[model samples]
Target: MTIELSVLVEEADRFLDAARIQDYCPNGLQVQGRPQVRRIVSGVTASQALLDAAVAAEADAVLVHHGYFWKGENPCVVGMKQRRLKTLLGHDISLLAYHLPLDLHPEVGNNVQLGRQLGLTIEGPLEPGNPRSIVLVGAPAEPMAPADFARHVGAVLGREPLLVEGDRPIRRIAWCTGGAQGYIDQAIAAGVDAYLTGEVSEQTVHSARENGITFIAAGHHATERYGVQALGRYLAERFGIEHQFIDCPNPA
Candidate 1:
């Protein structure tokens, strides 16, 4: 079945509530292509490799978690940006991206999906007041030692997580998918025993040690792959469209 590009964009925007929030980039269509989309390709980031894969698959549209035109990013579409956009436009492939919305969506969100994989039952948002707070608090299906929990995360995520274990067992955990190391303090404030995110900074180690909260730095790309994949599956089921998730490796 074929769906118009506009229709797909509308559905995605509605699913993500793109217009309601202040986001870093345009949430819906970043680049326009053919009017109708037949084969949809989903990926974590709209990097050149993902675009190349989409082109190789002869995809009509590329749905991604990270797209071009990020805040604080260079506006000039020259060099890599120009090459990427030109390739997509020249091949008539549309680009649809979702950032925070993908992270916070209750069902198919990154944080939610990661928690589920790790056997965590979501309690609430880590940041109490912010609806768009990416950090989430959850309790394990059963309490596990911090080291054991870290190992579980490593096993599920296909990468050894950097563990900064505290004395407490891990019953309540706070997580923010992707490079949200800065949210460790917020997680601590929420009184979570451990905090998990995709990447870690030098300060994160010190913060975790000083604050007495366990910290785990799972691979960024590994942790985030689930949400977009789940969203893609949903779209496929809902729209009866062909969807494929293209994985491009990023160690960080």
Candidate 2:
């Protein structure tokens, strides 16, 4: 089955509620392609490798969590950027990306999906009464020691997460996927026993140590691989089109 590029884009944007959220980059349809799409390829990021794979797979559209043109990126289309855009334009493949919206989604969201994978029962947002709060608070099925929880995360994500052990077992925890170490303080304030995110800074260790909160830095790429796949499945089921998720694995 095939659907119009514009229709697919519109449905995706509406489904994610992309317009209402403020994000670092545009949320949908970063590149224009052919009038119609029969196959869509989804990935965690739209790296050159993923794009190449999409092209090889004969995908009409590439859907990803990370796309081009961030808020502070250089506007010039030269070097790497030139090649990426050229590849898309040359093959007439559309680019559909969602950042915060994908994370904030209730059903197929990264956070919610991550929690589900790790057997965490979601409580609520870390910040009460804030619609834009990406940090979510949850609890594991059973209270686990920091080391045990870290091992579980490693097994699930297939990457050994960096763990900063705390004094107490993790009862309540907070998390936001993909480079959200900055939310530790907010999680701490939320009175969670642990905090988890992708990519940890030097200071994150100190915060966890002093505050007695277990911390886990799961790999950014590993933690975020699910949301885009879930979104792709949803789109495929809705529009009766083919969808494939290609993982161009990144150790980071």
Candidate 3:
């Protein structure tokens, strides 16, 4: 059930449209190791613990939503980066990562998967005018109260979300996973009843209160756990390769 590393990367790149978009970090194939991948480990982030799990699972490739080498990060392979890279190289395991592209993907994307799990039907982009909007808007099949909606998100993601109450019922909602509080303005502009994101900022409260939009800060890791796993599932089915998703939880 081994597939060539090149072939797998190519397929992922094509599926995610990784090249066309500008991202802070490189999208596909962050680290190259084994030429052929028989087993893959997928997770939210490429943290040390997750890498250890991948090694323990004997995974030939490790795929994740978050990977190393950001836009303005230090280029030196020192400290944590060095250790992580060492582990992958030592085990001959490839590192494949996708960030924004994974979030925006129509199928198996973070927002879409999370929305489905929460019984939300997709409406459209959160920012209707932005062609490359990673955030998405969705609605429950039946509208739920603000508090009830928060509970539903917590239940689905297994993380208690911090609810910032708004004045009205939440029918139309928008979300972007993983520390996207900065996009609250876009969500507000979209005129949704509520906005959900991973991390909350100091000003988020003001935004929510002023705009009368319910704000839910679901855990960054919690909200993001699905995209990579979904991609892994797709890869397993498409390529006949074994894939295991290792959950590495983070409270924030």
Candidate 4:
């Protein structure tokens, strides 16, 4: 079944409320293709490989969390960007991307789904009293050891995370996916036992150790894989369209 591209974007914007959120990039319909979308291929990033996979799948639209035209990125579409756009335009595949909005969604977001996998519900935002707090804090039914929690993360994401141990067992955990190590201070201020994010910086270790908070640098790609999939599933179900998640692995 085919759904209008505008309709898809409309529903997405309604759910994500992109207009309300302050994002680095445009949140919806980055590139237009065929008006009617029948098949959608979703992925973590809108890279060349993902575009190729979408083309191979005969997809009418490509939905992704990471899209082109970032805040500081070179806007001139000459080399890699040119090639990627050429492929999509050649095949008439729409590029639908969501950045911060995807992460902040309550139900089908990366952090939310990650919490679901670990049997935790979002109790509060890490930056409490803030309307748009990206870092979230939650606790499971029972607290587990920091090492055991790291194992659980590895098991769920299918990649071992780099661990920075804390002083005590993890009771309350805070997390934000996709290179959000800078939020370690916020987590520490929140007084959580552990902090989890995608990428880690050199200073993140020192911060974690000094603050006595466990830190886990789970694979960014792995941690971020679920939100786009969840959105794709929702789109498929809502619009009666075919959707497939094409995972192109990136260790970093």
* Alpha-carbon TM-score of each model against the true structure: 0.97, 0.99, 0.97, 0.97
lDDT scores of the candidates, listed in order:
0.90, 0.95, 0.92, 0.91
Tens-place lDDT digits, model 3, residues 1-252: 899999999999999999998999999999999899999999999999999999999999999999989999999999999999999999999999999999989999998888888888899787677768888898888878999999988888888899999999988999888898999998898789999989999999899999899999998999899889999999888899999999987898
Model 2, 1-252: lDDT tens per residue? 999999999999999999999999999999999999999999999999999999999999999999999999999999999999999999999999999999999999999989888999999888779999998999999999999999999999999999999999999999999999999998888889999998999999999999999999998998899899999999999999999999999988
Error of 4 at 25 (Å): 1.0
Question: Relative to the unseen true structure, what is the C-alpha lDDT of residue 235 in candidate 1, on a scale of 0 to 100?
Answer: 80
List of clashing residue pairs for candidate 2: none
**What ranking of all candidate models by lDDT puts the best one first?**
2, 3, 4, 1
lDDT per residue as tens, model 4, 100-158:
99898888988887788778768867766777888889986788888998998899889
CA RMSD of each candidate after superposition: 1.1, 0.7, 1.0, 1.0
Q: Lowest summed-lDDT stretch of 10 residues in model 2?
A: 123-132
Best by lDDT: 2
Model 3 misplacement above 4 A:
none
* lDDT against true structure, model 4: 0.91
Give me the runs in candidate 2 sitting further than 4 Å from their true place: none
Model 4 weakest 10-residue run by lDDT:
120-129
